[model samples]
Target: MKKNKIPYLLLMIVHLGLFVVTIIKKKDKKPLLLYYSGIGMAYVFEYVVLNIFRGYRYYPKVLKRNRLDSVFGAIVSQALIVPVSAIFITFFQLGWGWKIFFTLLYSGIEQLFIHLKVFKNRWWKTIYTLISLPFYFWLVSKWSIYLDQKPKKWIGYLTLFFTFWVNYLNINFVLVAFLKRIIFKKGWSLRKYYVNFIIAPIYGFIQSIIGVIVTLKNKKLIGLGLLHLVDQLFYRLKLIKMKKWSVYCFLPIHIVLLLVGSIFKQQMLHLMSESECSQRETKKIQSPI
Candidate 1:
């Protein structure tokens, strides 16, 4: 293997081994889900920042400048690192000192990758990673603890907001970029950026907000179906246009996004409940007898 590939391969092996050991030791479903969810969220976040936004690129170009390379790299890198880090944070019960140590250690590793040229930063910075990495670890740790709790209805709404935002970013940024490249034989242009970053986000956020309100007030499927109708109307009004086949293709994608949003809402609510429960238990324990 090439020199650059060696680092990624070794990192994968080590992480996979650690992940397996973690699973074996814990033998619990909640942490496992939290770990996997962390991985998924990391992948999606990177897809938006690195891939869609062109914030950075991987060296040795996994698939030689193809979008598939970015996708593959995102999954492997995220799966190798984020989930394992999440497992440590969520299951290991580390104190604040240890948490800080791990956070810095992870950040240092990212710096090492930069040194090795495995990661080529475009608009991304090490400080950003330093800040966000710890936050993600903290979030996942809480999520793992709260995976079983019952959440309030408002939690569902928050989840819907996050899910829709992520899905919208994926569809409008990544998907549109890919299609423009492949079908229209176009390159990245300012217009595309404006549409993907500004227009799509605004429109998608509105649509998803409405969908969530309707779903909460009435039936889920009906509300989701209405979202599809709204999309069609956008096309009819010439706000967005695509071939009939392309529109058909995106229908399932939209549905999947909606389902993911709904499911994630439940998980978020559970996490929220877990945080509340922890606070209550602490208060009770501190009270005089």
Candidate 2:
């Protein structure tokens, strides 16, 4: 029993260490709410699907206390984004099926690269790029359709993109800076966050924006190639790491919030409509005088 416990404890420690390092290296914390919400919701759905819907015990199961970030995170790392993105698509009046399809597509491609050990092997990353060049072209097409509804106008598109980037940067910067200043007693500088914050997003956004532009232009191959190149570059530079958990953790909570907000919005609109109708009726009654 003691020996068996040792292995589990060691694994947990290693996982916790990885989690801590990942958190520390990350410059943003703003994504926390998004991340937690999405992943949490994913688990709830996965749970229902496996237990209630399918009538099967969740497979590939590990003991709860044995998990590093907690068993919940493990569940979330794989599933949270599904329902969350589904809700978002519903809110945006897009096809929920497409949204789910794209999310799964994105996750599959991302995981394939990670599991293939491409990141550690730069040559593999390059070779894989050349090999999958055509597929990614089709992949970005899906992304374009999925994201098209996000930005109504060019300005809105830019704004929405900028907002996402800012939010990502803010998550890392504020958390890191807070720790550095409060715990380390180090002075804060605006430039640190500004330059650092902009770098990753600029790289990622530019690459993705190009993919989107190319998809729009019907130059899918060229766009995907460029996107792949950017992905490789980021990986080679170690600028990006495949998030260990499923993006689901970030989605559910936010989806519920967005849905709740929309519900309130509908209520407000209905109330306003009623008020206007009452005013018109009142005017109609008094007009004879």
Candidate 3:
């Protein structure tokens, strides 16, 4: 189905609005208010930019990263970048050209973490955040005088492109890996590959919202609720824990990857569809028991 645009746009506006509110009230200690808000806002923005706007491909696959560590890691990572990105974009008035360039550069630097095993090494994970930078700014820009008048219409397309890859990475990668960690901690005995590879995607989709809920209540069940029986198992097995405000890794890899991927996604999709159709007519696939 063709992607829906309105919900995505509305979500983006909401996220940017919240982000703005946080910036305005940066001086105030809101007691985990921003962190909780960021979780819902981030998911919405990430979903909208990568899934709703752009039609790039993201498989429903996840990696093997511990939920506890990834959550903390995300917090540490974002804390470092937020000030820098915010300062550059706002005080320095970095335009799209600079934004795009810095986004790619920063992403390449972060990708090192993936390779170094500081985080899971998924191909899409490394680039999608950079790709979203343009989209995020375009949303923010529309509310302010941040863009050139001639490029008005173009911003929507660009925002959409960035949104696709961002969703791909967040859904297809980051969220699943975190869920794997949580599952294992709960002592739900299972093969690692199945946990990280098969069950992870299904759980990842569920946990994406859980991560959002983690904000309202720092406990795992609060966000996702008691859907799975193993809730207490993970709750009991905590080697590490994050205080609700940590998971903000806003690096803008989406904008960078979107620019590159948009050029290729359509062609790739076309080729894949043709290849699949060619084999479908000859094959009556067996159902798995």
Candidate 4:
């Protein structure tokens, strides 16, 4: 409960409050998937602008001296708050007018944060946020609609990828950022946390992506072996510190990521099939002579 954290804490409360309300209102629909998707999508966007390009800085004061503190702040804004807001709008199907209002709302909050000194405006412009968020929210709305309907295969792929990305990022964050279980310093800039938290998760999912392709080709063993080899490569390069972690622990998790991805992909596809059946039933009823 540091004084500086109040801003982020308050924002988290407000955003999460809205999220809970949406959950209670639409609990049967299992809106959690869309929420996870929003976070995953935001992570990619944040990775590019915040981690890779250093577009901004955050000072949440949670980690205090470490760069992870700034990233924690970014996580609060990008991963938690923004995604929940996106879900709120999407679930409610807020109109274009509401979308414009939210665009302004987030833009205002950005400047307000800059003024409050919790956020740093580096290479990022509020104007960019102003321009990007409408499209972002619109895209998320389409994500919800796609999953609601007879979703296309590629949409299912992207949704599952993003969903799996959220899971992998959170678990890896707990192990690396919070618990300090292992370190990934091999090819990154001096063993930076971003290397593992951001880049490594993408590396992990690429394995899963390949797993999907290989499974389709009936080469599941090749996929599993590739996972093993990648894990070993990370360990052999001394990229990972084995004091509190090891390949024994990590390899299975990598395999599990692929499994979870595969399972969810099937679930979404089944949802599409169910939607198709429902639509056909309605059409049949309406076509009576």
**Candidate achieving the largest lDDT:** 4
Per-residue lDDT tens digits for candidate 2, residues 42-137, read 333333433233322211123332211222222333233232343333334455356556555644643553554321222233344343423433
Poorly placed runs, candidate 3 (over 4 Å): 1-40, 43-65, 78-84, 123-127, 143-289
Q: Which digits, one per residue and each the tens of the lDDT, describe model 3 over residues 1-289?
A: 2132232234345545645655565423221222322232344543443333331222111222343334333333332243234333533356778777766766675565444444444334645667665565444434223122222323323333333423433443444354422222123444333333333333334433433233323353333333232334333444112233222222133233333334333333343355456456446464333
Full-model lDDT, candidate 3: 0.38
Q: Model 1 residue 213 lDDT? A: 70
Query: For residues 134-228, what per-residue lDDT tens digits would candidate 1 score against the true structure?
Result: 78878776665445444445434544565565456456545554555211212345343333344565566667686567644646677667777
Model 4 agreement with the true structure over 50-105: per-residue lDDT tens digits: 87888889877888435688878877887878888888888887899988998998
In angstroms, give how far residue 253 of model 1 lies from its true place. 2.9
Q: TM-score of every model?
A: 0.62, 0.23, 0.32, 0.87
Each model's lDDT comes to 0.62, 0.37, 0.38, 0.76
Q: Cα deviation of 234 in candidate 4 (Å)? A: 2.2
Each model's Cα RMSD: 5.6, 21.8, 20.1, 2.8
Candidate 3 to truth, TM: 0.32
Residue 63 of model 1 has an lDDT of: 57
Clashing pairs in 4: none
Displacement of the residue 244 alpha carbon in candidate 4, Å: 3.7
Candidate 2 vs candidate 3: the TM-score winner is: 3
